[model samples]
Target chain A: MREAYHEQLNQLADHLAGMCGMVADAMELATKALLDADLAIAEQVISDDAKVDEARSVCEEQAYALLALQAPVATDLRTVLAAIHAAESLERMGDLALHVAKAARRRHPQPVLPEPVKPYFAEMGRVALKLAHQAEQVIHTKDIDQARALEDADDEMDDLHRHLFTVIMDKDWPHGVASAVDVTLLGRFYERFADHAVSVAKRVVFVVTGRMPGSGDEEL
Target chain B: MREAYHEQLNQLADHLAGMCGMVADAMELATKALLDADLAIAEQVISDDAKVDEARSVCEEQAYALLALQAPVATDLRTVLAAIHAAESLERMGDLALHVAKAARRRHPQPVLPEPVKPYFAEMGRVALKLAHQAEQVIHTKDIDQARALEDADDEMDDLHRHLFTVIMDKDWPHGVASAVDVTLLGRFYERFADHAVSVAKRVVFVVTGRMPGSGDEEL
Candidate 1:
């Protein structure tokens, strides 16, 4: 019975990692749509979001079932609880990617990225996708160092986000107000996408160390 | 022992409702700051967000303790799980309010809302505050009808969000590119704030009916 419960917990982790992969794929495609004005890819990302949402619902239901039947305690309990939170974080990441895809679709045929802002958004996309991939690995490995490193990566995304604004706020911004609005929102979607990855990584660290990330020496 | 566990579960609900109240207050103040250019109120909202975060942490911890110690099953287990999700929703609402405050601060001494957009945002604020208050009631009453009504209110917010873009995209948009960016983000913040409220309400409906809200007769 104990072995079975442990196996269930492992399955929950695997499901979460699966979610991370889906989000990474969605962001990768959504970013491509944003850069190339590929309407088909953007639409695909939007439709694909439902799959992530369904996976999250399944994951959470499994969690409730495990708790009800197994009543896991101590470390096992924390692991399941963290999985629930991590599922939520990943679901939100998928939603953020969906938002990115929607933005791309809204500007369909007309590239959402003004030429000046194109390179910055391309970098944001790469960073966001990389973070998602790294986050999936952290979910499986529970590497505390790697989880902490995701935070540093998030800081880089933030820098990129700030620089994006500078380009818009530049006195010589060639694009009109509408383009600036789209660019600002696009920057936000990518920044928030990275933020969710860091959040999931933090939960993974908590699962491993039983110490909430950023809680320092304070034990949970 | 059963009675004690039940009492703990009630406390968890109370904590969640308390979070809803804090988020409502934060949005109210943040909106006021945005319209009036009140830096102090914006700063107050920003600083107060930590309290909401702490409250959510406490609420989740209590739920975890109840699950671990009581080993609740069936409806009781579902209630605890819903509380965890609801607490997260409220915490995110608080974050959205914090964002509204931060945006106001960014434009400090200068109102974030241009004159043409002021009334629109003002209405958004009222709608958001109304939804938050209604959401608090839904948390306590679990009134399925009221919970469902929150979705209609969310539709109202969505309409307002769309209208905001229309105003921004108007040929006579009085504000320049930067102001348009600010207004667009402000609209998004309010829309998302209301969205969190609707999500919490849906969870409440699920708790009461044992059928997922929007799932209709389909059982999850």
Candidate 2:
């Protein structure tokens, strides 16, 4: 029974890592859909988001089962509870990706990113994908260093997000209000996607170090 | 031990209700700051966000202690786990309020909303505050009727949000791209604030019914 309990715990972590992988792929595809204006891939990402939702449900159910039947204590208890929070974060990351895809679908045939702003988004997507992959690794390894590294990578995303804002708000910006609005929202989606990835990494830190990374959602 | 455990559960519920009250107040003040360009009040909301964060930490700590010491099952278990999720939703709602406040501060001396868009924000603010209060009440009563009511109310907010976009994107829009960006992000903040309030209400329904309101974060 103890062995099975531990196995269940391991499976919980594995499930979280797998969800990260799903969102990472989702973010990548969504980014592609946004840049290339591929309606089909965007639609595919929108539909595939259901899988991430299912995985979140699975994570929560497994955590509940572990708590109810196994009553895991100490580190194990934290692991179960952290799994719940981590799944929420990853699921949010998936939604952020979906929003990116939706942006693409909304503007089908015409790319969401104008030429001037395309590079910023490309870099943001790269950083967001890297953060998601790091979140997956952090979940599996619980390596404090790897988890902390996500925060640093997220800084690059933040810079890109801020820079994109300047481009949209620039005096010479050719893309009028509509395009500016689109870029503003898309920038936010990518930034928030990175934030959720950092949030997932924070959960790993909480589980391993038994300390919070910051106050709450604002910081994360 | 059983009696004490149930008290802790009630405390957990009470804490959630209190946090909603905090955010409801925060949302109200933030909206006022946005509309009036009240720098002092905006600054107050920004500083006071820490209280919401503190409340969240306290709730999570109380929950962790409950799970570790009590090993509650059945509804009790659901109550504790749902508390964790609910607290997170409430905290994010607080952050949304903070973001609105920050938007106000960024454009201090100049109102964030252009004249035409003011009515829409005024309506959005009213609906968001109402939802927050409803969320507080639902946390207290676990009233499914009230919980479901929040969803219906949120549709109004969504319409207001959509309408704001139309106004901002209109060719006659005189606020230029900068104001449009501000309004876009502000609209998102308000919309997301209402969504979090709905999410908190859904947690109550989940505690009572063990069902999901939707797929995950996107729907929430």
TM-scores, all models, native as reference:
0.95, 0.97
**Model 2 lDDT per residue over B71-133, tens place:** 999888998988999999999999999999998998899888888998998899999999999
* Tens-digit lDDT track of model 1 for A1-220: 8999989988998999999999999999998998999999999998998899899999999998899999988888888888998898898888888888888898788888889888888899889989999999998898999899898778888888888888898867877888888887888888888888888888888878877776211100
Where model 2 places Cα greater than 4 Å from the true spot, the runs are: A216-220, B216-220
What is the C-alpha DockQ of each candidate? 0.48, 0.66
> CA lDDT of B66 in candidate 1?
94
Q: Candidate 2 — what's its lDDT?
A: 0.89
**Chain B TM-score by candidate, in order shown:** 0.95, 0.97
Largest lDDT belongs to which candidate?
2
Q: Encode model 1's per-residue lDDT on B1-220: one tens digit a residue.
A: 9999989988998898898889999999999999999999999998998899899889989998998899999888888888998898888888888888998898788888889889998999999999999999988897888888888888888888888888898877767888888887788888888888988888888777887866211100
CAPRI-style grade of the A/B interface in model 2: medium
lDDT of each: 0.86, 0.89
